[model samples]
Target: MADKSSSNAYWAANVRIILISLVIWFTCSFGFGILLRPMLSGISVGGTDLGFWFAQQGSILVFLVLIFFYAWKMGKIDAEHGVDE
Candidate 1:
């Protein structure tokens, strides 16, 4: 019973984390990178709009940040839930 409850909690926690991470990912990628391209048109980088950088390089950098953040957060989450392994 305890194990099952813990498992359920772990799933719920992970799901919440993933959903939050994806929302941030999408916002940073499609929102600033594409959807709001016109708004960011004034900013340029090496003969390219900032949005272009966001779509290509910026998103990848954000992804790496998210990855490390997720790893750190998940580690804390795992320890909190007693599921670290």
Candidate 2:
């Protein structure tokens, strides 16, 4: 059925979007915040470790941004797929 096909497409699009967002989330959080902390040690923020800032605040901010981006992008995707109601 055409409706079924469109629904599948919509779901696929959503899944892809989520995967991309998660990769970005991990890169900003664990990668920069923990694994790469040493390299950024000299760049102090608020008189504390740059890595600490990334692990705590930066990640949180990036998460919020990703959440908003996902919501906004998915809304448009849904509308395009005629899945918005």
Candidate 3:
């Protein structure tokens, strides 16, 4: 009863985190790099538009950062629930 509820809460929190991360990844890689490129044209990086930088490099960098962040966050979550390995 209580244990099941707690486990469900943990899974729900985990899924929420994953969904938020995915949204950010999508926004950075697709929304910024392609859909919003024209709107961001005024912002330049190395004489090229910011969109180009995001498409070519920025998104990947952000993805890497997100990976590390997710790992760290999940570690804390696991520890809180006594599920750490």
Candidate 4:
């Protein structure tokens, strides 16, 4: 019974982390890049408008960062759940 509950908690935490990461990625790639492009146009980054930068580079960078963050976070979660090797 305890093992089952801990397993459920681990999966719940994992799913929550995944959902948050996806939201961040989507907001950066689609929201800033498209929906809010006009609002961000006034800002500049790397000689391009903020929106363009996010569309072209920023989102990709954010995704890479998220990948690392997910791995690091999951490692901690695993440790907490006594699932780490």
Please list the C-alpha lDDT of all candidates, in the order they appear: 0.89, 0.91, 0.91, 0.93
- 1-85 per-residue lDDT for model 2 (tens digits): 2498898898899999999999999988998899989988999899888899999889999999999999999999988987788
Candidate 1 residue-wise lDDT, 1-85, digit = tens: 2398888988898889989999989988998899998899999899989999999899989999998989998999889888777
Candidate 2: which stretches are off by over 4 Å?
none
| Segments of candidate 4 deviating more than 4 angstroms | none
Best candidate, lDDT = 4
Per-residue error for 44 in candidate 2, Å, reads: 3.1
In candidate 3, what are the lDDT values of residues 1-85, reduced to their tens digit?
2388778888887998899999999999998999999999999899999999999999999999999989999998888777787
- Pairs in clash, predicted candidate 2: none
Tell me how far the alpha carbon of residue 84 in candidate 2 is from the true structure, in angstroms, after superposition.
Answer: 0.5
**lDDT winner between candidates 2 and 4:** 4
Q: Is candidate 1 or candidate 3 better by lDDT?
A: 3
TM-score of each: 0.81, 0.84, 0.94, 0.91
For candidate 2, which ten residues in a row score worst on lDDT?
1-10
Steric overlap count per candidate = 0, 0, 0, 0
Best by TM-score: 3
User: What is residue 50's positional error in candidate 1, in angstroms?
Assistant: 1.7
**Deviation in angstroms for 64 in model 2?**
0.5
- Model 1: runs farther than 4 Å from truth? none
Candidate 4 lDDT (Cα, whole model)?
Answer: 0.93
Q: Candidate 3, which segments miss by more than 4 Å at Cα? A: none
